[model samples]
Target: MSTMPTLDTPVTLTISPDGGIDGRSRRYEKFLGDMAGVYRDAEAWQAAVSARGADELVYWVDDHRYQEGPGALIVGTSTLLPGRIGDEFAVTRGHLHAIADRAELYHCLSGHGVMLLETVDGQSMAVELTPGKAVNVPGHWIHRSVNVGDEPFVTLFCYAADAGQDYALIADAGGMKSLVVADGDGWMLTPNPDHTGYRKA
Candidate 1:
């Protein structure tokens, strides 16, 4: 068997101006109109978002063993585009931990946004995010983040190495029941009708 890398030296990770963790970083992009029915005005939003070319970006560390399970620690940053999807703002593709009891932690390093969380049993909530803010995601909840400001939303995340993300669970549920969007001078929290409950803006 191969030995693990020696820890005799400091392992340095660079954060790009946009909050990307350098060195073999992987990026996933989502255009503004990506999530079709997740918004109130689907067709209108799709046309508007597409015309603006707004896109969200998720940057992940290039370590190959993250999905291997057990002791692996996965960390990365998601830079949500500074725009809206109908009444919703730019957001990450949320996911539930493949290992049900695996929790995750997220630190907001830059920008303004909120972390939307929900459990399979119907509990839902949101945590506002600003520079230096951090939030914990319980193992039983599926979560995602939204950029509700005029600038890019960036946040760093850490989770158990063995905890894999189940994106289909979130997609199948039609996304979180609530959304964060720009509200004139600040931001607004609104409801996503696709999900069961309604949250007023």
Candidate 2:
């Protein structure tokens, strides 16, 4: 009988702070049109689609997934281009890990941003990150990346390989519990009126 394949060998990854890895297994891109219904300002998003063209690149992720199972890890970089839609800044689609209890770590590679976090139980937090800063996001939290600066918000992230993202959770709840908006020269978190609270899976 044929033998099962052996496990993967350890490898060195040359990661770039600007959002890339030398041995990335895949790259995913999100365009302006792909973000419909994500921002609270519907009118602004529509106007942006008209002015910038629907296919404009909004963000991209490069990741390396070497294995699968309980102990495997997925490493990657997220690059979010800076922009504004109404009073809100550019943000990732956001998600809750499918496993629910899987945690994550994000290290700021460049630019200024915020890690917007919220829990199903009404807990909310916004942690600002500059180059060299990092956030260890605990499990059970809904998280997203917000770009609050003029440069691309880039971050290096790693999480359990089995921690698949539930992208529809936020959409089902009518958006997250808070919105990150401009506060003069800074940024602030305001309640999202449309949020209907999270529904347990």
TM-score of each: 0.79, 0.96
Off by over 4 Å in 1: 1-10, 53-67, 196-201
Give the C-alpha lDDT of model 1: 0.69
lDDT of 2: 0.95
Clashing pairs in 1: 69-162, 70-162, 72-161, 73-161
Q: List the residue pairs that clash in candidate 2.
A: none
Worst 10-residue lDDT window for candidate 1 reads 57-66
lDDT tens digits by residue: candidate 2, 1-201: 999978789989999888888999999999999999999999999999999999999999999998889889999999999999999999999999999999999999999999999998999999999999999999999999999999999999999999999999999999999999999999999999999999984
lDDT of 1 by residue, 1-201 (tens): 999974433346676536676753365556554665555567866687567654633222323223445666667776776766566676777878888789988888888888988888777888999998999988888788877777777887878877777877765656576777668777777777676532221
RMSD of each: 4.9, 2.0
